[model samples]
Target: MAIAALQHLTDPRLAGRIVLKIGSSLLVDGAGCARADWLRSIAGEIADLRAGGQEVVIVSSGAIALGAAKLGLDKGGRATLADAQAAASVGQIALASLWSRSLGTHGLTAAQLLLTLEDLEDRRRYLNAASTLARLLENGAVPVINENDSVATQEIRFGDNDRLAARVAQAARADAVLLLSDVDGLFDRNPAEAGARLVPVVQGIDQSIRAMADGGSASGLGSGGMVSKLQAAEIAERAGIALAIVNGTHRAPIARAAGEGQGTLFLPRRRDGARKAWLGGRLRVKGVVRVDGGCAAALAEGGSVLAAGITAVEGAFERGDLVEIRDPADGALARGLAEYRAEECRALIGRRSAEQAAVLGYAPRAAVVHRDHMVML
Candidate 1:
């Protein structure tokens, strides 16, 4: 596919929070050290954004690269899992210190958060992480997040910061996500290929779009390629968050991407009901609740689901886990964050608010699934 010309940028910074994923190639040098001057420049941009009342969250890569540089462990450009983890242990401290110092120069406080797949995948931990992020933003602190590579096994890791950024954006309910890459943007073919131009705006990613994805990082420092970025875009798209792929090698990458239309922005599904978007796009629904006709009618009209309306409960989900609301004929009707555990739900089946207290030996929340947390499918 031939790349289309650049369209006018939608001003992704128009409202709400933004997530920025910093690629290794952008932050780390070939010698495996942080680019101090470049970081200061990036921090200046962040300071400017913060002054404008726009919150920013960063998902930065380069721990392993920095570690490898420090340890001189680049054996044929590949290391054992143990060696990689050891490098990460040393690099994480170096990365965090550098981030803190750079942002501090601008009088901005940096909070380092090392996360693994479980932090975002587990319901309880997800909420905890979300709460912490919310508090940091509220207190005017910039969070510098990274994968816990030191402890994260290859099997249980996010491998690339691109998808992690999108997931963080979804969890943080950011209005937009920016993936700063080595190349200019999403190209029609390998960016190194001749006559390959940048695609300004992605309508939606399909198989053909997937075919256009490039291979792994040529620098051999980063794990992500254009393919991982598209996957990230897909995640952001489903979460109703516009995601942009822009070159981070520039001076003001964020400003350029959001204001000057300098990259390929994947348009969001819709921003009007982002909560609903997140709910609907959940990759895993821990349980299913079959609701009666009356409840279904109420839900369709944007009402909450009452315990009295629930006929059956399936799946051993915990409180706060996502669940599917179903009807016999309609199949899955909606998705919601459950207020009660599966066992408690079963005990409260067909019971009203008062009866629920007696059956479960405790007063239940007003709604089985609050309307605010439920999205009609």
Candidate 2:
């Protein structure tokens, strides 16, 4: 609603927080040098949004590209993982300096954060990252985030900034995500083909929509294509966040995306709780807690999973790790952050605090998993 989300919606919604995913090509060239003027324009746009009371987070790609140039990597050949990481190691500093200078020119402060997909996957690290972003926003500093290419391996890498931006949006509790690309947006067919037309609005990422992106690959110097944009849209949709893919190569691309039918706007079905959204998006659960019928009924009524209600603790999980809550029938009910370590939880089974204290020489935490940190599976 404000300036980055879908302004075309029948009712304009106030999407206060937004995350912008800028591809490598938009930031640099195949030679990996910074695109100074274009970056400044973007910085100015960000400043305008901030003046209008909007908080922005950026997931920028270009470190590797710039680094490649610094390292003298071939423009025509693919860089190896080590080469890419090495390039990122050198370029990250330049990338940060570029953003800092650009944003500073507009009287805005820039904060940089390097992250890996694993960072977002781990509950503790995710919370830490989220907290850092929140504090930066609170202080009116625009955060420029990127994948930790210098340290991450192929097994743990996000592969592209698009999905990374979506995950960051969820962590930052953003209402919208904007992916700036070379193309205007998703087209009905390959834009190179005759009669190809842009799809202004995507209601949802269905089979037909995905099929439209079949041949899409990375554009410019970016490593991702239209398929990556769709994947990002899917992630945003899960968290009730709207996503837009717009042509950043043009003037006022952000403003253009806000205009009707100017970009592909992927709408969310509805807004979901930030914690629930994060919980549901997690692909791994460290443990399972089984509760009795009464506990299951209470949980269904929106109650927490209390220590006295838990019948069994399965799996080895540390405190603050992800866990699954199950019923007497062993059916999955919900997922949450564990308040106690698996060992501690096992010791607290069916015991009151006083009883736990008598047996273990200390009182234990009240719940196996707090309702506030849980989401129904």
Candidate 3:
């Protein structure tokens, strides 16, 4: 069944947001210098996507490789953490400049975002990062994201851009994730072996699927191998995001991946439901809000939880904390990330959203929990 799916693998009609992860090997040569021609070709592809009204976010790896080349550390030895950090600092500047220049030729602006694991793990920081990416896309700029390797220790680092790309897809609510790597797609066995074949469409990831992945980087310049990409697929799957792995060595690889379906596609398990399940299951419930019968009905109809609908707020939860919503009878209706702190919610219960300013000192949002942030039980 999987082999049959491979024969007909074609790109789905991907619209709106897309996250493209570029491996270090695709961006740097053996000498560790940025591949100028390849970068230009990719920039052209991104420009085409944007021209067609698609928002593109790039999670790129190459700063360390580029830095290593520049600092004479590319002499074929494993670099120390300090050496890696120093190289990242120098390479990041060159990387940003290269991307900026490449995209600039096509009249596109590139914005650099250096992130660490903590940025996505912390709820408040996650929202901030999401908002920033949204704003960049809204303003017609492409975000070039990279791990903050300069200050990141081994314990705090994401260790691979494959997983980082998946997290970015969740944060941006991207429609699709494209991993540009050395290989065309996932195979049942090593491609170098005789009779090895591509497995193009994966509906679900299982132990057998995972067993297919060999644990070594595709190129010396990259740290993530097939295993990391599969792990990334699982993360993306939980967020209900489609993921594709494509060979990025070809010219206009992004265009080919999107149009010709030149890669393996991992279909999402359950669109919105998967994301809601992941969100609700992962967070700790810090508080509860009780609402009237009318509000309960509204929640059931998939409406946002408003201040006027809330009758009472319990427990001490801060903004961005996960909280539960309950009916007047104390039956749990839903759980969502709180927009306002517990004290603020207490002061605004039963008050109309318009009257929030009069009831409290300020009113930033009308809904206590936005529909997008809420998971209905």
lDDT (CA) per prediction: 0.81, 0.83, 0.83
Please provide TM-scores, in order, for all candidate models, with all chains considered together: 0.72, 0.74, 0.71
TM-score of 3: 0.71
Q: List, residue by residue over 92-141, the lDDT tens digit for candidate 1.
A: 89989988998898898999999998788766777788889999999989
- The best candidate by TM-score is 2
- Pitting candidate 1 against candidate 3, the one with the higher lDDT is 3
Model 2 ranges with Cα > 4 A deviation = 1-5, 8-13, 75-78, 215-220, 283-377
Backbone collision count in every prediction?
0, 2, 0
In model 1, residue pairs whose N, Cα or C atoms come closer than 3 Å (at least 3 residues apart or on different chains), thus clashing, are none
The TM-score obtained by model 1 is 0.72
By summed lDDT, the worst window of 10 consecutive residues in model 1 runs over 1-10
Global CA lDDT of candidate 3, please?
0.83
Supply the global lDDT for candidate 1.
Answer: 0.81
True lDDT of residue 278, candidate 2: 79
* Candidate 3 colliding pairs, count: 0
The alpha-carbon deviation from the true structure for residue 82 of candidate 2, after best TM-score superposition, in angstroms, is 0.4
